[model samples]
Target: MNAPSGASGYDAVVLGGGVAGCVLAARLSEDADRSVCMVEAGPDYGAEPRHWPHKVLNARALPRDDVWERHTAVHRIRARVLGGSSCINGCWNTWGSATDHEEWVRAGGPRWSASAMERHRLRAVEQMGLRAVPERELSLWARAALEAAEELGYGHVAMAAPGRPGFGTPLINAVDGVRWNAAFAYLDAARQRPNLTILSQTTVNRLDVRTGRVRGVELDVDGRRETVVADTYLVACGTFGSPALLLRSGIGPADHLREFGIRTEVDLTGVGANLSDQPGIFVPLAPTPDLNAALAAKEASGNLYVSRMLIRAASDLCPDSSWDLHILPSAGAPLFGSLPPGQYEAGISAFLMKPASRGHVRLRSADHSEPLDIDPAFSTDPDGHDIAVLRSGLEIVERMAVSAALKPLAGAAQGHPSRDLSDEEIRSRLGAYWHPVGTCAMGQDDDPWAVVDEEARVRGVSNLRVVDASILPTVPAANTQLPVLTVAEMLADALRTDGR
Candidate 1:
């Protein structure tokens, strides 16, 4: 657990070697003059493909084992490896719409605007080697689903491209058949740099803040306590972990800190507030004879089962903006343990991309090891806007299930056979897409609820910045991986330019 020989102090100590952490560590270390240390709470397999477990390397579906269980509502799944969630996510690379970043500008100013963020987005995409799945590789079930969506007047289902929104095969960050995670993409090339030190299996206890500046971090390395000092610190521990770190360090609301016997240091009320995520519902359909046969043939040939098609559409509620609903169609029921062994089902998961409902993440105790209380407060928007949009999406799914192109392939839906469920019923079955953000929201000065400023620096804490999904003012209309990477890249550029 001792420092990696000569690693007593560093120019920058990045906590949590996840998607954003890997990007920042790699980019910052490129200077060759700055000493960087990345501490990850999980195993680090280096850059070799052979070192990774089968689940981490598999690109077929998301691994469900590594997750933070949110009380009964949903399990917040995030990978605990060098690459972070990028190692086990759906591999969907989406940038959302221009309006998504425009809202960031409104909240955090022009620096985060779409035009300003384009270069970072491009850098991330190129580094990750993102590419659209070829049409020829589409599974039988996927083809039928796209055809049915178009027949139902959802327009031509094509592949998703940057700055464009429509129905298409989602671009993914996968190479061949392996998940091309951030560690493999970013950290691999920089692993040999002497200035960069990656400490695996190291959990951050809290930021060692004194007199308003973070001096170092107390860590739990294999149950042994240790301290690592740095001139500056970046918390990239993700949405759930980042804010929890701040709260445990007595940097949250003063009243909340008092209740846990921790003296307040910063008293930032917004540390764990304004939590938001996409709530989605699954519509399962039994596969038709033809679909089943195709699947069997493909299985026998050992062909890769790729299901990357998605539909982005605007509901009646938010017609003026970019699409607010994501219809993700899959060849098989990918949700872990959702179906029986031999059962083959094709389905679509509809997510309310831009939700109005908000929630919060609070500490159950001052203990850093204890899980935080995560309440997404799904479908609880006072105006009932979230539910209304979901209802419209449900109707669309029903129509697609019965369309001529898919009617023969899609049998009766598993849970709701009638599709005539009331709005209350829909709300009862709401679940999250697991894209949590905004816990440590970035906003302009004078905003009491803003935990961080446009530069991603913690409002009242000096030499400490949070660069992760937690800083996103609002969840984008697409999957969070690409957006989070872009933010990290931009922040790294800013830090480098500042010569910190």
Candidate 2:
């Protein structure tokens, strides 16, 4: 309603300066003529890595700082920083199977094919400087896990690209001990460009979508309200944040918006529906004295990463050439809490990579600062397929525990082993892999569940697009960091090709 209060309008105003936002802002501004602005809810430590908080830059552990919610439900955890989850995740990069591309191609188009997306994936890998886990960085626990995978008949294969089910170390975006997040990898150099403007500590209140087009964006910066306009508005606020923003702007299910008395501009029910995320259960193991000592030494040398190697294992229910699980073995400082001086936590976690269950994200209210109602619905499928696949993955955990390579390092199950646990018990222990997607999934126009089209444009809304993990129709059977980066890169290419 009101004229934009501050700076002049931009060619593209990117909401949420997360991983995808960074890539889009950097790539779109490459034309030099197009002005781009990236707005983030949290602080940006500038372009210098040395200025960032050490806890955020440290690759060995997940820092609790710069998070949306703290000491709350683990399932709702997501970073609020400029670099997004990349600043707080495990710093590992792994690619999904070709089967994942088939699913995407079915929903979107051939552009999502493995071959079509390969160049984008490789570009993301190169831009981030991803490298395989060095021998010194692999803790003794990880080395033993590698041996156990080989002993179990899983032939070695790369983790950064698709291949038959196998075990190997993942490529990492970390250098030495520093976590090279998207901000550092993509935005650092872009900061030097005059065409790009990075706005930190700015929260998007809502989009002024009128006549099926975004008019302007209401923002809250340092408690001061203002409006910013752009020719094209790109929402890269991530899975949870993106849908929540749309809902606040009355772009979700009409019935739900009516409850909050917000006028609905679009009646799309898929804006926040079809939420998908990987659910995993950790089978804790009591480490041997030698294991703890080795881990301690690794910590002393700043190389103690909780996990480095993983096995892409096919569940019995999985297809022939695809894997449905990631068997992760880790031993080091606990992800959440600390241990006594030389002691540590050790375990093998079985992650249900390709799950069938779905969840939804809803607006708690119209307030921008209010957290969205997020339900992962982990293992809540009606037919119990997800629970069964997770159970099968746990079986792999049991076998990995008993292998000669791991049995000597980590003695036995410390508490109730996953194999002996009932379905309900296992569900109680379920932890998310921190990969949430499909909030604004892409699909054909005929699909009622589809929110966005193949080009990441929201249905029935012009001058608006969502370029982030939120646009993915399903969570890939891998950690989502690299995939998100690649998706951003591909969408940026699409924008460039169209000259929008």
Candidate 3:
């Protein structure tokens, strides 16, 4: 973390040094004149991969370290490290369906179209070092799952590039077993800049807003209070953190901020609304003896990837030529809890990629350290569209589990979660894929709930912009890592152009 020298303050104070924050700081600092400071709540651990925790570097399993919480609720869990969720996710990267872009183009104009974003997308790919899964990394279960999808009439399709719905491996940001996070990609070289500052383990309390502008940011640095003034304050604190920061600064619904006894600066109703995440249901299966032995051998070689391929299958409710469900199968160490020395857990999971159900994030209090109140509200849409689509996906899971290609290795399904339960039971046992977006959504000024404009600048507040997943009005039907990185890179380009 950097300190306050004789220099007054930074040119741009980028709050929340997550995926987007790292990119913004690196790109903006390229000019050699713009002073940029990146504030992150978690420890930076320096710029070397060897300096990072071993658990964080291992890509075979999602690490519990460097996260916001360590409870049983997976949906509420979020990364708090400099690299953010990229340091803790499954490393699967997918460009969502074409229909998702149509929605983005409508909300954010032609600049968000597929053709427009392609350049930025390719740049992110190169910077992040995303690559296809190699043959050595695929476990026997993954191979069998691929054959199973093929047997079921689905052909192999590239998951990284936008294309028709099919099954194939996703582009991964991992090499060997190390997790290649955004900090390593974007922030390593930027740290050498004399004008760039990386502040870690520093908490942002709130923004000092008066009238229609932000004056400075109130931060809690090493138990001491400080105020950092900047020409512009950009909030890239992610989907949950971004909204909570706005609400604590008195920018959310006037009625909600009043409940916290905070002074209101702007009454933005969409600061923490429209939370979207992919909810999934896992169907357990009894692994065959040979399958267990094969998995054991793979683990011995340190090349065991629980899931290497995924099926993007279109449900009845999905838009034509686009998929709304991600069917994943896995056989490895349990995602939660543990298995015996030689035994492993096997299952097929159905993820509702394009859910219609919307949720929200709210501040429990004005305190910055306290957790925000988050309600994913999965499968709660009034029309039951999410429920219907999820059930349809599970139906596919059941068929895949019993298919000849998979049955020989996984034996038989213990019982499908949806076989005999009501919709309530289905909802109770559901787990999240951990791809969340849309808290501070983007829109035109006329839209009542729009928090930011197409340029990601917050409404009614000059010089305050939000460039993260929170600004996405709709969740794409794919993992959020790639999309968020692409958005940050694109916005950084625009901001650099303006400064020039």
Clashing pairs in model 2, backbone N/Cα/C closer than 3 A: none
| TM-score head-to-head 1 vs 3, winner | 3
Clash statistics: count for each candidate: 1, 0, 0
TM-score of each: 0.95, 0.98, 0.98
lDDT scores for all predictions? Answer: 0.82, 0.91, 0.90
Top lDDT: which candidate number? 2
The residue ranges of model 1 lying beyond 4 angstroms of the native Cα positions read 1-7, 68-73, 156-165, 304-306, 319-321, 338-342, 414-419
Per-residue C-alpha lDDT of model 3 across residues 1-500, encoded as one tens digit per residue: 65453324878999988899989999999988899888999889789999999999899999987887777488998889999988999988999989989999888999899889999999999999999998999998998899999998998898988888999999999999889999999999889899998888888999998988888898887777788889989999999999999999989899999998998899999989999999999888999999999999999999998888999999888889899999999889998899999899999999999998999999898998888899999999999999898889988998898888899988665554456767998999899999889999999878998999988989999989999999988999899999999999999998887772
Local accuracy of candidate 2 as per-residue lDDT tens digits, 1-500: 12235746899999988899999998999999998888899888988888999999988889888999889889899889998999989898999998899999999999999999999999999999999888899888888899999999999999999788999988999999999999999988888899888888888999999989999899997788888899999999999999999998989999999988889998898989999999999888999999999999999997888898999999888988999999999898888777899999999999999999999999988898887899999998999899899989989999999999999998776576677788899888899999999999999989998999999999989899999999999899999999999999999999988877
- The segments of candidate 2 whose C-alpha lies over 4 angstroms from its true place after superposition are 1-7
Off by over 4 Å in 3: 5-7
Give the clash total for candidate 3: 0
lDDT of 1: 0.82
